[model samples]
Target: MNDKSKSVKFFEQLSWGIWIWSFIALLCVSIYLSVWAPLGNIAALLVTGISFAGFYSLSIKMRTTTKIEGQMLISNKAKIDLKFIKSATALDAEGFKRLAGVDADPAAFLAINFWSKTGVKVELKDKKDPTPYWLISSKDPKRLVKALVKAQK
Candidate 1:
């Protein structure tokens, strides 16, 4: 039987607050420019609208739920059930070599952001959910993969 405990990781809500604040700042800048700068009110409005849309997108992206259990990495939005992952296979030798160069372990798993370029991404077989699935980072990829493999059985 799989012995690993189930854990939930929710993205902090404070991140949403930050995005809201950024949007507000952008709006303020746009208003100021509209009143005092060469750009007309129409241009300012466009800039403000774009900034708001960008922040809105970021807010949506920041919200997510992660479930890690014996041999499975699940995301509620994506409805992904990644089964039978081997711990060693979680991070390949090349990834490990890269981490080693930075005094880091490839096994460590971290959440992915817009900036991250490396990590595993998987999609659920089901077609209901729209969010993409990921196994972005793992501190012990091999162990996690092994746990997943065992859980799948």
Candidate 2:
């Protein structure tokens, strides 16, 4: 568990390798279009540059924003309070699949991304809240669970 008075932060982001490879592929396509297609050099460059910039910007914003702050779990799509969290457990790929598929609660909130093969399941304790739990995809599930548990204190 984490120190009761100390705040700990945990974050997850898209793999840089994935981003680089995607950019490379996009570059290749753009170059091919510029050289062979009727769009021409200037138009192709502008289109490709804009497209790449938009994609990269959105990806970075979305990926990097998923983080834990103090006792709050902050993601691009949701913010969760650790006080409302009863327990947190890390899940591997198969476990994630099973829980999300067969054992999923209809009232649970999910902020899952397929790029991550692991996740953390947080059971909610707040009876007043209709949400049963949360399933959040993570690049580092163990660390995330640890952080959540620590924050619980």
Candidate 3:
């Protein structure tokens, strides 16, 4: 859904697995109730449809989006200007685990999801800002890092 002008360099949605699992659980419950109460298949289908709509709304509330708009590094939780960033490191699954777990900074801005194992760690240059870095989850860490680096320049 991006235009040819390419103002946005990266975009990803986290926790899509929740959408799949929630729908399956709701459908199963609908079928189980149909077996016990003699409700027709049409009624079960209706219940399934209604549950899907509710779950869609809930997933939207839980989902986190990461995107770069112009020179801004943004997520559902927070956004920052690229000018304040010093460097961007693309982390693999293992590097991400270490930084997100054992080496995490208390003052860092975290826009991470457990389901996302690859990401970027953005070090901040602005001394006035208390935050040391930003930890962001991405489906493609390299692409995200590339975007952030380009924006910082």
Candidate 4:
């Protein structure tokens, strides 16, 4: 019943929200050093290069990925088969806030990243698993839900 070519696959990469500004600040620091400090051209270039590399490494390390590969739904923190999913509901900002706060289930698997406020809640049907559902933060909840639903079928 499965066709690999037609199977729905979605991949999303989420970076730390403040990284861009931090990177810009790094560049500004290098400029300041080059202009104000009595440093050789090679020294300035080396400092800038090393700073950029360090910032880039930090950004990559902090990034998280959400992927739907064939029948599997993969998050940075967890993964589940689409067949085990019973339902998925897309959440807006208010709903996400409430469920993630007061109404949250302790047993739920949270793949929440604080940066993105919108998300999807996936309910599971697997009897063996104690976890009630998965709360995942997604930039595009509707599209993620649609992809999951399509893959499940």
Best by lDDT: 4
| Candidate 3 residue lDDT tens string, 67-146 | 88877788885888888888999999999999999999999998888678888999998989999999988888898888
Q: Each candidate's lDDT (Cα)?
A: 0.48, 0.76, 0.82, 0.83
The pairs that clash in candidate 2 are 2-150
Candidate 4: list runs displaced more than 4 Å: 1-8, 18-52
lDDT of 2 at 56: 68
Model 2, 1-153: lDDT tens digits are 557443447777654456666766777586658754886777777777776777667656556346777778876668877788888899989999988889999889887765667888988899899998888877788998887776666
Error of model 2, residue 147, in angstroms: 1.5
Stretches > 4 Å off in candidate 2: 1-6, 15-20, 23-36
TM-score per candidate, chains pooled: 0.37, 0.77, 0.76, 0.74
Error of model 3, residue 89, in angstroms: 0.9
In model 4, what lDDT does residue 100 have?
94
Supply the global lDDT for candidate 3: 0.82
TM-score of 4: 0.74
Worst 10 residues of 4 by lDDT: 1-10
Where is model 3 more than 4 Å wrong at Cα?
1-6, 18-47
